[model samples]
Target: MTSNPTSSPDPIPNIATASEAFHTGDELRERWRALMGPLGFSERLLWFAFVDTTGHILPALNQLPLDGPPEPYLADLLMYRLSDVIDGHDVVSVAMLITRPGADAITPWDRGWARLFTTAADLAGVAIEPIFRANAVDLVQVSDPRADGRSVA
Candidate 1:
């Protein structure tokens, strides 16, 4: 902790000290959503991932609809998990279509998503410009990425 004029301090690693910001942010968003409740965000949105020739992954906005929610949905819920599925190939872009909240409310919930996508691009060592159209609240109150069989009571 040298503040001497002749010495400099080490730069804080990661974006905006966001090394742990993603998870902290996710928790914050979850709590915010819970606090706002009915006055906040919608329940569902669209999610799409694109894969390049090499099988690299990038999520994108796809109008094409699948038969239903992703399999093993854990009670019809969409897992916002992408870290494990977006590498080793040629991913181009990812799109998450969020539903507009009834009001003009924009929370920091976007931070986590930003972190995930940014990390992917960083690892891939490419510059990516993301286009955002819309997004919905990721969930009501479940914080665990793999928490299964939830009961809304």
Candidate 2:
């Protein structure tokens, strides 16, 4: 029996360059879909909402849940893989919800999340400033139209 190379599988494309080639939100979303391949609605929603006007990072923050648990480091790793898409640019905004004074105090969970975000930012070599808020409602004022676009309401 002859081995068939064509019937095997195609090599995965390099994500760095693939992400750099994205020129719009839709392009980024498509590339993300290609990379993630069968993700959940939350994951898809996160990627779609985070791509910026130029199809880059800042927009991604808008997709994360302000009050939910931290996503695994893999998600951050994937974001870092797209570093070329926002290298040397001011991209990524980390926002935290604070309900009261001194509510921004760091906890074990916060430390873990910080490590993920910081590590991803370092690997990506981009700016990811943290924004602390007094409440979840504060984020509503800065809502993304693209995020709203996905809303059925």
Choose the strongest candidate by TM-score: 2
lDDT of 1 by residue, 62-145 (tens): 432323332333212222344344443554333232333433233344334434444444454433333122323123221323
Instruction: Show pairs that collide, candidate 2.
Output: 50-59, 50-60, 98-134
Query: What is the per-residue lDDT of model 2 for residues 48-110, given as tens digits with 9 covering 90 to 100?
Result: 223343434332323444245556665476556556554334433222221212222344444
TM-score of each: 0.28, 0.33
Give candidate 1's error at residue 15 in angstroms. 37
All models: lDDT? 0.33, 0.36
Model 2 scores worst on lDDT over the 10 consecutive residues at: 133-142
TM-score of 1: 0.28
